[model samples]
Target: MPLWFDSHCHFDFAEFDQNRQSEWQFARRVGVSGLLIPGVTHARNLQLEALCQQYSWSFALGLHPYFLAEHEQMHFEWLDVALESSLACAVGECGLDRVLAVDDAHWQQQLACFSTHIQLAKRHKLPLILHIRGCHDEAAAMLRRARFEYGGVVHAFSGSEQQGKAWLDLGFCLGIGGAMSHPGAQKLRRTIAALPKTAWLLETDAPDMKPAFWRGPANSPAAIPLLAAMLAQLQGAELNELSAQLERNRQSVLPASYLIREEPSIN
Candidate 1:
């Protein structure tokens, strides 16, 4: 079977603490060769780094928008330091959220935080892993203003065709997850069908975005193949063919240095 990559997953989260070893094994057995673990806050950088280093997995370091209450300007300073010292692949799991930021001040804060991450990614010459929710146009405008060079993936994409094209024009790939598997997600499914195959990158966003079959349960990287299958069905392509194309898409957007390495033995 062709190897698969979970371009976004929170394997560092405590949900995997008790069974991480078996989880990794299950992922490997299911043809998941690699995973990208993106940090949501400055505080988790150490833990995220350690997990990636221990498993030879790739990672992205940035401050997520939802945790605004927990972050401070000093965190950006720490993010700058972390980027220089660590082997992170990109600069996010960061972006704006319309619902999350209720007021204008809060929305502005999200914009500022997102801009800082964009600048950091530009400075580091790394791709961004954006987490846009209900603010695709806003995020697209910011990206256009920044004129960012390094491309990235927009994780958990569920937007209109126009919105999808906007992000594509900015040189970003869309991360497809369990959302596409839902029958009720007809609009998103139509968007996926309308787009070219190169516009997508498969992800599980584990411990979240559970697939239709596994709804109500914590997700795992092992479910990536199922996600890929759903996407392939929607795109009218063979599983392996779509998998190969998605891998190429991932390589195109993410920094070359983010390539997966062999995992170290648990013992």
Candidate 2:
């Protein structure tokens, strides 16, 4: 199997609680050498930290827009502590969303929380793991206004080619997940094809965004290779070639220590 890494996975989610160990082993066996688990709620930091540390996996600490209501005013201080410590390698699963933002007040709250995550990422000198939805323009504007220098991955990117380029211009990458495998994702596939392949990351976003080819009870981190295969076909490149480029793309934004194990030999 070609080497692979899942740049954004929620392996800590309850979906795999019963078989986390077995599931992870299966992932590794399938060539998924690493997974970057991002925090979605403050209450799960330590739990996420412990899980990642236990398996020597990489993780990040941040408040996701989906769970903003659960985030307390004081969690930012706690988040700072984790970021300053050795607990995290990145600073988010943070960004704006249109579907969740029911009103101006909710949108403002997402903006505020996303801004805080951005500032935290800047302060710690870590890349972000953004989660932008329909508000790509707004999110890109915020990142530009914040002068976010450290580039990161934008989870589940559904933007047009222009929007993808905008994020790329800011040193950010678009995470390609199971969604890219859907028959109806022609636009997303086209956008990926148009953008430089170097500006993408492979991820499962497991327990969610299950690929069309997947018929399992839930998505698994192992879906990375499937994603790689799809991307390979999209780019009309060999799997090994795509794998090597994916590794390089991820490493450009994240440090080596974040993903464990030696990378697959690239030739």
The TM-score of predicted model 2 comes to 0.95
In angstroms, the error of model 1 at 43 is 1.3
Per-residue lDDT tens digits of candidate 1, residues 1-267? Answer: 767889999988889899988888888877788889999987887678777888878999988888988888898998898898888989988998998977999998888899999999998888999999998998888888898978899999988999999888889999998888877999999999999999998888999998888753599999888888888888999998997898888788975534454553444
Clashes of each: 0, 0
For model 2, residues 98-197, the per-residue Cα lDDT tens digits are 9998899999998889999999999989999999999899899998999989988888889999998998899887898998888898888888888888
**Candidate 2 regions with alpha-carbon error over 4 angstroms:** 262-267
Top TM-score hit: 2
Clashes of 2: 0
- List TM-score per model, in order: 0.95, 0.95
- What Cα-based lDDT does every candidate model obtain? 0.87, 0.86
Off by over 4 Å in 1: 257-267
Task: Tell me the deviation in Å of residue 108 in model 2.
Answer: 0.9
